[model samples]
Target: MVPKAFEAGYPKTLGFRKVVKATIYVKKKEGMSDEDFIDYYNTKHAQRAAPILQRHGIISYSLTYHLERDRKMIQDIMHGKAQLMDYDAICTFVFPDYLALAKFLYDKDGAALSSDHDNFMDDKLMKMMVGDEYLLIEDGNKVG
Candidate 1:
């Protein structure tokens, strides 16, 4: 989640503008412990990414870990069916605007991000996209 200070003072009473949403899925490399992978991501990788994201005009960045308990709940909901998603973590990167996102995509900073991903992420297992959010409800009130 983004820091409260970063949130705009006014809500988008109109439709929300589209923003880049880079959702990342991590694949733990062979022989690397899960603890090590998470530590490097949270400490070294994420730490390094903050400045780059800021420079690229990203609004917020956050990581969601796939916990064992959540996995069990998924299995239960599926009635012992197949796994819906197989990934260790999901990362969301929000950009201020599509133009800012485009700049990041075509700039050297993007290359740096890609290079860093090579060190800790499996490109083959990754899924990313830029999307707009449609708010159906906000604070229990209907929204456009």
Candidate 2:
């Protein structure tokens, strides 16, 4: 059965939150191993960006590397033929509101971040999806 919450449909019915979430798909630059890419991003990159994120009203940011071995295993279990996704990593960021997000983009700190991208990842291979968040679940439980 569709939960009573979801049966109503869409954000308002689901108790929409004003926060926006941006999911970014990105690929490493040529010749960087997965280990090197993850290391540089986790250690050097995030350290540099922390202040900019805090200043821009970003609630949080996280980046996760896509595991090819895990993908292969899942495909094997399903008896499915599959190809790897183009992206090497997925990065997510949360913003407090539209104004916060706009400021994050147009502000000087944002410019610094944009300029910094060339140091590690392939900017040409990046894609982003931005949208508001609604909770259909909180922690491990369902939400109504």
- Candidate 1 — which residues are off by over 4 angstroms? 1-17, 67-69, 76-82, 138-144
TM-score of each: 0.71, 0.81
Model 2 weakest lDDT span, ten residues long: 1-10
Off by over 4 Å in 2: 1-13, 82-84
lDDT, model 1, position 70: 67
Write down the RMSD of candidate 1 (Cα, Å): 6.4
Q: Which candidate is the best by lDDT?
A: 2
lDDT per residue as tens, model 1, 40-142: 7899888877887788788889988775666788789888885657777888888766666666667776667677776666777887755656567779998
What is the TM-score (0 to 1) of candidate 1?
A: 0.71
lDDT of each: 0.70, 0.77
Clashes of 1: 0
